[model samples]
Target: MRPTSLEGLPPTDNTEALEPQRTAPARSVVRGFMYAALGLGMMILFAGLAWSIRGGMEPPSTELETAPQTNVVSAPDPQIVSFKKGRLAYQVHCTRCHGPEGRGDGPDAMALRPPPRDFATRPWSHGETPEAIRAVIRQGIPGTAMTGWSELLSPQELDAVVDYVGTLGPLPSQNTEASDARKALLRRAGFEPVEPTIAASPLTFEGLDGRKQTLDQEQGKAILLIFWGTTCAPCMDELPSLDQVAKEFADAPLAVLPICVDEPDDELVREVARTRTKHLPLFVDRTGLARIQYDVQTLPCAVLIDPEGRQVGRLQGGKDWSSETVQTLLRTITSQATDLK
Candidate 1:
């Protein structure tokens, strides 16, 4: 018989229908929900940590930004640098023969005939201009110890050295200018008007009469100084003209001095003066002071000094010093007509 309640049910032929269905536990459901919430929280925490690290590493951002400005310093002058280079070059190559001060008194210069140029004197053997100086340095003098340096020095180096060499040259003296009228007279007389450089070298020398004489050319008195040597033939040949001029100017205010550049007691110098130079006093350099002070590179160089002790002009090589033109030159040099500005 079928029962109204399961509790009162009895055994039946189909017993599968009488079993109860299974349900999930409430504790297990609660535990699963808690685990899901924990997992979500962990994911949020990890994302926040990653963002914090990225923010710390990055640089702070600014609203406005621009490139930095810099102050630039100018470089030194190239010519100044080149000048220093040139000084070094001169010390190495030229000082051996030209002397440290360019006085032509180097130790090696003692043996060389036609001694190295004294840059202190304005007269260069070749020329005085910068271009002319460069030519001489590159091409060199044919019959002298000076050899071409084009192959040795670079173009820049050559120019630099030439500039330095100019520094060794003479400074302009008081009378640097000559009036046009005076200039014309000088040319006709074969006198190369000296671009007055240094002051007059003091005239302190020994005389042929065996006496120490310190001759000073006074202002308002004109004088001519002839630098000669007993060894030089050209200098010897000019003695007659010197004697003639000495006599010609004896009565005048001008004094013609033929200074002997030999030793104070040189027999040849004494003999030459005794036979050749009459009327003119034989003044010998006692200590070679004249050559050194006057920067006399070669013999037969005549310097004309005005009344003001200003060296007005120079005549190189031998000349007929007593000629009418020369006499006129002498007279003009002594005259007050040539007003030097």
Candidate 2:
């Protein structure tokens, strides 16, 4: 009975042998490697973006990001002390060619064969006004030694320099020194001077038809002297408006005369005819004596000479003569002619 019951003996105590080995640490190591690779890729992408934008390749910052929100009003125009500051600037910068006091004789004059401009002469190297001088200074004279000073000087400084330079020589009236009687006659003739030695000369020129027309002959009439040249693009540009002005004043005693300083008179004559400027009395300056007298080296210059040969107004650059303001000035002068006498 003991041998037959041997197969159903008591249970064994080896339960630990039936469990699997631990693998959690190895799985964790693999997962950590993947995450490290992912982090490295992300960091590379951010670094690449930063490198691309670090240099001049980056676009300008937005106003909100870079600029302040406050409204920055510009500073007012500078207050000037006197003409000496401008004169000093010219002596330092422009004395090479323009000379001290703009007499065209600087220390560097010996270097330049033609030397510099002699502004004291009747035939001025440039125009009379600051604006005209600025244009020349900024743009420079071609085929000459004069270089543009636009970069060297600020606009205000240029203006100051021009104002100082404009005082280089005697004024328009000084070209023809008048006697005491002539001066008295001018005053009696309703001529007024804005600055000393700056009276407008009496208009006396032989017309195209050889008619000896004087300012006295044009009394009770309005005359406009447009100083221009065929070579001047600005002068050509302003022709249409000038035509309209002449037309508006046709019924009135108004004459628009365009005077050109180009030689070989027929060239300008052809230009006037081609442009169809019938409203204007075209005159060509063969000898260029008027250029010497009027100090009109700059082109497209205009002067408003009243019927009594008094210069009521003048303009140095291109403008619409048919403008309302110009018309008002014309009307005012026309109405005041009677009182001028």
Candidate 3:
């Protein structure tokens, strides 16, 4: 007879059917877990690749840190006092009385008795040489609205204005014989005539490689001597551009020497040269003898010496050495030296 319970039934074809029903759901769950694990592994691999690509696009941290501190200081052209600077100075200081073009018909000129000097007329009561004009700018006229600008402007600014004034009129020819005679008379009377340019004193210093050097050794070549210090912010700011100028004249007979007005330390100078100016040759003045000899009272000054060992000119402050105007000036100087040879 057919039994109600499995124990009383004969286990034959129905036994296999019961086994398949119990194990089917467990197999489906195992397959689902394996698929989920594979998807997670693929996501991790893609994330790693994206991170590497972004890291490769950026520069190193050291390069980024030193880039901004390279060179940012820029002054007016040092070779010639620039007219652009002169015009700006005139607008600020002389526009009210002398007018824009220096016609002497400004708003304040009408109220004055003697009136501002008419630069267009070229009838200067004082002398018309650059020296005379510079003197007037520094000392002012005895009876005029013009005040002494020695306190207001730098020597370079005064020179720029003088050059601008000459553009407005035909400057008188300089009387060299008379000037010499006057200077001689003053010397006889126990007075000294003020010289327009100061001569550079002799300099001797040690190089970064621990070799002794002297300015006399560079006599046959035009030398660009830069006085800088590690502690000076402006000096550091001007170094990179100066190095670029040196590179441009690598084949020329120009000696670009950056003299450090600090204690002599080969390692320190080398480090500074490597990071700040890669191509520049460095010299150190341990006793400040070079600074005293060159009369460098300011940081970031440059002294240009001709092939004859005479100082051509001196720039008293920082300048943009890589500017087009500065590059032209250096080229002219180098060309002149080549012509002499």
Candidate 4:
């Protein structure tokens, strides 16, 4: 017998009892939708806030500009006894100004007054003996950019530089008369055993646009002339920083000329100009005329020429043009030019 409600008239349907269960699932779905919407709203709000903060910030004027100052360490007894060690040391410290081959015609050699000493030449003024060369490296020549490296390099490193230098030229011979005569000649020429200034010669090259450009045309403006070549590994390394510098001073009255010393065809030159450099004006010295004019003996060098057509500064090897020191130097040059006008 089926059970019937005690007080009601009709029997209730069993489905009616399941109605709350169905409604409960619906409520749960609604809550889940609400939670999703709230999460999405929070994400949007954070994104907007971040965008606003970013917009309010200023663009940085410099990038990785400052380098930490290093403390000077006294050199220990030289442990670099091998020629290989000396060669490596020379490459690290002397390659920029002295050149990789110790030719004394490093890229920056042209800008230095009296120029660097040609290791291959006879009669080294500082003496060809390893000890003499080491002394010069430790003491540095007066009135020149060659600062004493005693504080910067270890004794082993100094020995290495000396050893490397000796390999480039003949060592001091028993005959002292020739060396003495060479020294006397240098003194007579007012070099004081070392010249104080080297004049920068004018250079001419074909621009990417087929325009014939000469250093003389840039006399009225300060010139930042970069001598580089494809064969030079160091020169290739410096290109990116050089491009940054070119862009930085685009508006200034300074001519940034990056002359390639490679002998490439017009199409190749155009390709290199378009791809390698960032729209920086490119020039080619196919005949090596420009290199000869500047007396560039090394790869990857820069010359800062004043309006008077005088080379005021020079940098050799790979340089960080983005550095604060480099920027300050450029600014100072610009300011001086303005004052003169």
- Point to the candidate with the largest TM-score: 1
- Residue-by-residue lDDT tens digits, candidate 4, 135-213: 8889999988677888977776676666656656643332467446534533332222212122235456777655667
After superposition, candidate 4 runs with Cα above 4 Å error: 1-199
In terms of lDDT, the poorest run of 10 residues in model 2 is 71-80
Q: lDDT scores for all predictions?
A: 0.73, 0.63, 0.71, 0.67
lDDT of 1 by residue, 1-341 (tens): 66678785655645554443222456667889999999999999999999999989977655323444221222323544676678789999998899987888887998887788989876676887789989999999988889999899999999988877876776444343455566677778887775433335445665565555544634456778899888788988889888988887776667777887754454667786677877877777655557655667878888877766656677888888878988888887766523542
Q: Which of the predicted structures, 2 or 4, would earn the higher TM-score when compared with the native? A: 4
User: Which residue segments of model 2 deviate by more than 4 Å?
Assistant: 1-199, 202-212, 338-341
lDDT of 2 by residue, 1-341 (tens): 46676466654645533332345677788999999999999999999888877855867678647876332322322322334457668888877776765667887877875667877666665676767888988998887778888898887778777776666654554224433433443334333332333224433444455343544566666667787777777887788788777777777667677776663345445655466465666665544455655667678877666555545455677776666666766665565455555
The sequence of per-residue lDDT tens digits that candidate 3 reaches over residues 61-160 is 7877777642222232232225556767888988789887677888799999789987766458798788998989899988777888999888778878
Clash count (model 1, backbone only)? 0
Per-residue error for 134 in candidate 4, Å, reads 44
Per-model C-alpha RMSD: 30.2, 19.8, 15.3, 19.5
Q: lDDT at 329 for candidate 4?
A: 61
Tell me how far the alpha carbon of residue 119 in candidate 3 is from the true structure, in angstroms, after superposition.
Answer: 33
TM-score of each candidate structure, all chains considered together: 0.46, 0.40, 0.43, 0.42
